[model samples]
Target: MTSYNASLRARLMPIGLLLIAMSCIQGGASLATSLFPAVGPATATSLRLIMAALILWAIFRPWRWRVARRDWRDLLLYGIAMGSMNFLLYQAINHIPLGIAVALEFTGPLGVALWSSKSRFDLLWIAIAIAGLAVLLGLDHGNSDHTINLTGVLCALGAGGCWAAYILFGQRAGEVNGMQSAVWGITIAAVVIAPIGLVNAAPAITESHVLLIALCVALLSTALPYTLEMVALPRLPTQTFGTLMSLEPAFGALSGLLFLGQALSLLQWLAIMAVVTASIGTTVTGRSAEPIEAPYPD
Candidate 1:
């Protein structure tokens, strides 16, 4: 088996990286909502990616390392995608409830899964999930602001598309130069977001508590989680990783409930269940005729 596939097998095991990814995501959401209230999503996101990149750069010292110029270009694109995703998703969360924002964001990958599938059964699962989303979103027509923010929903969708790109480019970066590529990729992403954060959140930096909260958000969301994901990604199949990632919305919802006191109505709870069930069903029973390839930052 290919090294990547072998790694996938290991990570796909129930007690492996899958659990770590979920944990990281859960921790990240809780941290973002509670600690970084003063900072906008973009600022919080930029701080985390920048701090995480700094840590990884210190560990890898990728600067002294050399790569082909072409590879560097790929890493740059990867960083852009990553930065965009962070900014957009955080922005989405600012306007919409965490659960709804996450669910909408997931549509990007869900669309990719549907488009890339060769199996009819995959189509069925994707259709069911999309229909469920439609039903859930229908509740927003004349409801509380928490129901949904159309603008935020669109932003979440944008972030999801960027996430798909990040995965695609990231895979290439990983393939070309192994972990070194991730080090550089995240650095580039951090640099890209730095200016945006400065412009949007520099004032808040003077606030002692805001700085502290930003650091906390950075550590839980970007620093630790990215490290764990990098360690895990190499070991899991692309399809399995995608399927496993379908849990992010559910995890986000749970985290919000636990930490932020975000409550869900019966319909919202049912929508969450529909997504969780469809995701698990697809992952457990759906067999891929060909390996699933995802896009990432290069």
Candidate 2:
């Protein structure tokens, strides 16, 4: 390829990968809802992780490979973070609207991204994001049901914090290849939840349809997009990757509507756009101080 085409391809690759990753996230939610009627968020999240771990382990056979002890530790930490983050976020979603839960959970990354803002422009972005969140809280119209559930919001925020940690540990885990890190990390997560998963997974496993759905969820939610991201990460800048990830909430809202018939209120939709715009505005135009690498192998 020519130099210009190569550069274009480099840029486009990340975009395409990110798009697919977001689609997977959206698909995950839809699939979970379809698989388990009235399923609690914790159960759904646990099942997804378990299924993903099984699939990855079967394919990679990380036992046959080797990795550094320090890297193994990083993967374990990343897996713990992933497990906790998913559990809390799903808990939030059970109480609140999925879109709102996702938006709230995004604050963790946004906060990390905005941590070093010496400029008024950074403050402006923060203000914009806060405004968007305020709209999301729906305090103006004084609709009680529309108001966010405090516990749920807190859980979402906790999930966001875990997500930020996941990102941090993920970089360390991704340093070496062959997906050994992912395998170990996911194994750690599954082990951590083994007690609860045993109780919840048994019922689903017994049902052939649920088993099929769980496998589908694992592929769409965890495997496919994660692989795509691993491929695109080296090609994209840290800020660019963060900006692309910011589009996840938008994709989630869209997917919820299309796949699960979960519609957002006009206010909620606007709120999602507001946070998304702020996140994009901050990342796409601004430079990230730290470089972030993808966590898994594509």
Candidate 3:
């Protein structure tokens, strides 16, 4: 009985970690958005990245691991991608609902997952994702703004593209220094984005609540979630991890609804489901789970 229970616990622990990681990330996004009205996305992204970078550096003590000059390019690229994702996704959530922004941003990794696959079934998943995106893009119709906010949608897509870049560059960077590379990458992102963010958010930097929320965003979105993912990665099978990670958009939607009161139409729900389904299908059926199982910066 003891052995059986231990086995069951081992099987279940990674699942819980992934779930918690997703919740933290989405919850953090919702929290971050609350600051948008006061300081805007630039400031919020800057604060999150800066704080997260510091936390990661302290935890990893990256100075212990030195990188070759040859590998610095990959780390730099990865960091730039990370910064782009933070800035663009925050900008996206500023203009669009959290769920929609996340759903759209997911296309980046989805594309990466589908890339290099020759399976015929992958085409179906691609089509489903596209259909979901089509409906998602139409969601802002009849709102006070009139028509969809193309800027938000575009920003989400751009964020997704950066995610794809992060995956590719991360693979290369990891070969050199593993998680230390992530620390450097995040630090690089902070350096690149801090100037713009500080300028934009300078007016509200003195506010206590703003600082508190930014700290929470850093802990919840970047530090906590990334730590959870790193812990869960080795324990879970690649496929299981990928499938669970695919539910992140749904988590984002739920976070938006629960935290931000951003209720969606039934059609929007269905559209998000389609994207979720497509991601699941692709992961479950893919030849390799490498792309999906990669540690996400979301």
Task: List lDDT for all candidates, in order.
Answer: 0.69, 0.74, 0.88
The alpha-carbon deviation from the true structure for residue 166 of candidate 2, after best TM-score superposition, in angstroms, is 1.1
Measured on C-alpha atoms, candidate 3 has an lDDT of 0.88
lDDT of 2 by residue, 1-298 (tens): 6999999987797888888888887778667766445445566666778888888888778888777776777888888987888778767766776777788888877776677434346877788889888887776578786878888888987988988888778878767763677777777887775556556553545677776787788888777776777788778777777777888778777877887677888888998988998888777655556655445211
- Tens-place lDDT digits, model 3, residues 192-227: 888988974667876999989999999999889888
RMSD of each: 4.9, 3.0, 1.9
Better of 1 and 3 by TM-score: 3
Best by the TM-score measure: 3
TM-score of each: 0.83, 0.87, 0.95
Write candidate 1's Cα lDDT for 150-211 as tens digits: 87878878988987777667767766766677777778888998889778675766787766
